[model samples]
Target: MERVEPMPLGGDVARRADAHAAAPLLNCLIREVAQRCPGQGGRRVYRLPGGGRLLRVREGRRPADPEVYTAGAWQRVGHTDLVKLVAEELRRHTGLSNDELPAEMIDSRDAVAALLAARDRVAPPADPYLRSEQSLVTGHPYHPAPKARGGGPVASWLAYAPEAHARFPLVLLAVREDALVEEGDTAALDALGQAPPGYRLLPAHPWQLDLVGGDLAGAFADGRLLRLGTTAFDVWPTAAVRTVHAPAADPAPGADLFLKFSLDVRITNDVRRLWRHDLLKLRRTDTAAAGAIEAQDGPAAWLSDRGYRTAAFAFEELAVLVRDGLGGHVLPGATPLLAAALAEGFDGNPLDGPADPAVWWEAYLRQVVPPVLNAFARHGVVLEAHLQNSLVAVDTGGIPVQALFRDAEGVKLLPDVTRAAGWERLVYCLVVNHLTEVAAALVERHPDHDPWPAARREFARHDVPEIPRLLTSPTLPGKTNLLLRWTGADGADARYLPLPNPLSGP
Candidate 1:
């Protein structure tokens, strides 16, 4: 749900869109297929193994300004040409023609262009939390097509896209008590509206309802279901597009509550659905994470996926997950911002301020690292603690006082995954995928600073057996999302590559 993406664009917006799109694409090419070619001056050169052609790009967090050496000199390639070059290179590299990935690359770029065009039109909510949710445009920095919305027309998904800063009410549905199948405490749903006798309230994402509405026509006609109209208050969609933050009802003073619904369409990878299997196991995993965090010493908390409700007939399609929101979990006087939002900045980012780097970085390490390691070592629970799943609540001085983690669907128990496999996932999600991005953002702002040494010390202080090896390892495993997508591997089945260890060296 979170990737380093081009922000709401300005200047020559077309060129901005091209660069933004090309950065992740170029990164994918270099990481998955291209071999490095040394001595290319200010730009780095890589050999496309498929064509044996030399290509160059100015490298940064997001590689940019790409060129291909042709006709005795380097010639720049725009996003269009870059896509063609990547296709040809991949053909030679993998010995397979991937018509799908290439189209997705183009689709991602086009989506960015569309988002750029629409960003200014929709007014972002006054709430900073909502702003962070919609801040990502360059999604999944390593993903080739982070913004490809199932290749549908821009108009199809634009109204629901978080990047567009769109907000709307959920469509209310009343399923007959006989038809409603639910587990856990879904009291939050009943609070949304009153249900007629013999029926229960089920709030659905309007976009998802639009996607699966036709299938439910029979139920509506047969009177098994009834429409209670839309909710009076609008809910802001978060980075995980299907999950929304619904503001508390007026006259009730409390924190916002989160509602996640099944989305049939694919976003980055998997179809966004609350699958039946995951729902069955949700309570155990949520209990593990919740207990682990509660047992810890600090203010760290786990936003439990308290329970789920779904129609018995269309289980996965109609499933809705209720999760705890920021109200009670976040430390008082501290504003909790998405870790992804901190990495991919937004208006009023605490990181974009005057906080001392060492102190801020140390506090961040303390808040984020301990709970993850503790969860894995103490409770044998592996949290997908990547940036999108993390929240850092910063005090008035913009110092992190607590960390809140969510999404039980992504949680893997010790025995569910081999301890070895779970450890790998925890390292990837917590260190490579989450901390590295945050550290890089800090360094980018500080210029001459190195935040990784403190990171090394943080891990070294942990008593877990994995810490020493992690600190000394020559490389850390980084997810190869582009290659994973190209190979059509399940997104949950992560494939990794050895990236140079920043924690071990300068």
Candidate 2:
């Protein structure tokens, strides 16, 4: 992963980690629980209603330098103190206590610290794409604990972590053909390695293997699963720790593939697993998404989740998804960078050096907005176009030329959800989650540039009936990640609160 500068694990490392950890928590706190209490001089001040405490911060897309009012003055709190403050406020606000989320918040900070330390010893990949994929240190900008690795010991997950520039070979297993349960096209798996006559090839994440080893011991012993050693090539983990990408295979050409696996660890709100229900519905969702993107007029593409394979004995625990890689979709001369990495600053970020902010951003809006709107309006497919799920391909001149959207598991079919619900989700994922972050990053980089006008025009061009209301709506739905976690709601069960709509602003 591209890093900010190298720092010794000691000295300012803890402070830096504190800052990294604090941004998202602060964002969630201010967005969900804290009420705006007028501007304090040039800084933003908020009143935490539950605790009756006044807090102030240097606010932007990513708020920072937090200070709480106390003793007739303001006192800055470290991450530990911030976690305690958040917990106390949530407890009072919700009338319930959550020890786990706070602990995860701390774990997330410590994980950032460990990632910073590990990154110092390693060299970043020469490939800019890999660097972009691994660039997230503060992940999920609005999430309370985006980097928490199930609170597991540093030694366990560090090596597999993408933030540490991790690359490793997949553990190859041969499942008895009769014991394997698979769907759709998974032929790509056979080429990864060879299996015996009665067995099918199944690649596993080493970290996941370690997590579920005991449960699979019986299968191994009884010959339902056979060890076939590791793949010859190393795969790089993406922002999503469980999904891995295999670059061009050594002698074989066109061997690029992305494999998604079941991770027992909880990175964000939910345990990152390839759940059976989603897996069963994958092909249908992916097919619909692919068809929609194909029908769109622009260069936007859908990275289809082609298929999955697993042992029936441990369906959810052992499932691995096959997704189309960048080789086919990306433009010939352009580089595909993770959209999240662009929002989260990376070393060679394309947004950093755009010649004209207007042209670049207009191109970006052109490539990204239409396909998403068309898919929902024309095909009843709602893509999870959040930053993490989107890839923006930029040409050599650092101009965005194409947008590739992925992860069918997160796609919601139209009739599956009511039209209102689907539009709300499309708005949240496309506008609130995706465009807002990109626009914020652009505005932060070029202070004089305002991106919303172009965004408004882009939405105006789309024929969806909801576009008109969306353009005039005074408020946009913002997912309450903090409240959702504290209330122990399912990760998929999204609850939203109103956020000021810049689209409607003068």
Candidate achieving the largest TM-score? 2
The list of candidate 2 runs beyond 4 A from truth reads 1-8, 249-254
Worst 10 residues of 1 by lDDT: 1-10
Q: Residue-wise lDDT of candidate 1 within 4-96, one digit each (tens)? A: 223445657778779879888887888777888884677888988777899889967889999888999889999999988887776777677
Candidate 2 lDDT tens digits, 1-506 = 22333344796778888999999999999999999989887789999999799999987887888999999999987789999999999999999988899999999999999898888788888898999999999999999999999988888888888999998888999999999999999999999888999999999998899999999999999999999998877888999999999886444332688999999988788899999999989989999999999997878999999999999998998899999988879999999999999999888998899868999999999989988999999999999999999999999998999999999989999899998999999999999999999989988888999999999999998789998889899999999999999999997789999999989843
Give the TM-score (vs. native) of candidate 2: 0.97
Candidate 2 deviates by what RMSD? 2.2
> Lowest lDDT 10-mer window, candidate 2?
1-10
Query: Cα RMSD (Å) per model?
Result: 3.2, 2.2
Steric clashes per prediction: 2, 0
